[model samples]
Target: MTTITAGRLREAAELLGIRNQATLNEIRARYSERVKEWHPDVSQNDPAESHEMTIRLKEAYDLLTDYCMNRPVSFRLEDLEKDLEQSPADYWMERFGDDPIWG
Candidate 1:
């Protein structure tokens, strides 16, 4: 039940050089490229800097993946308010459909 703000999502997207609309595949590809570029053993830069960059890239990738997986289809204020009015089960059912195992 952690709340994810739009600002956080935008920051993660920017760090990974991706648009807000990027798909999971796009995120994974970009993350792979960045990891290769910043991997301490591969980059031949100051190991500390390379390690830091790789850590940052992994963090951004995790954040974006979590956001994308849990995000609602849209974020209109009115829609959120309406969703809040529903019971948790109803809200999840509406958002994710009737996947029995997940719901």
Candidate 2:
């Protein structure tokens, strides 16, 4: 229902130093670190920058948290089983090496 753009999402991710595919906990931890690093009460020497950064960081945190909270998730048994059961070679072989010529 939100009207967020891809650019805005990318900005939020970059602001919080989040890499691709972060879980909610990772996003929260990164936001906490960034806030602590820039909060005006803690970084008194640069209160102006700290204040500005704190505001930006909070917005980024809210955007990221909102996006994550609304994302759809799957919990099918086969999906979980696939994650736990795959080995590197088996994965490659099943997908690529199964071809008679390639194998």
User: Which candidate wins on TM-score?
Assistant: 2
Give residue 99's lDDT in candidate 1 (0 to 100).
71
Looking at candidate 2, what is the lDDT of residue 75? 82
RMSD of each: 11.3, 7.0
Instruction: Write down the TM-score of every candidate.
Output: 0.63, 0.71
Question: After superposition, which runs of candidate 2 have C-alpha atoms over 4 Å from their true positions?
Answer: 78-103
After TM-score superposition, what is the CA distance of residue 82 in candidate 1 from its true location, in Å? 20
Poorest stretch of ten by lDDT in candidate 2: 1-10
How many clashes does each candidate structure show, in the order listed? Answer: 0, 0
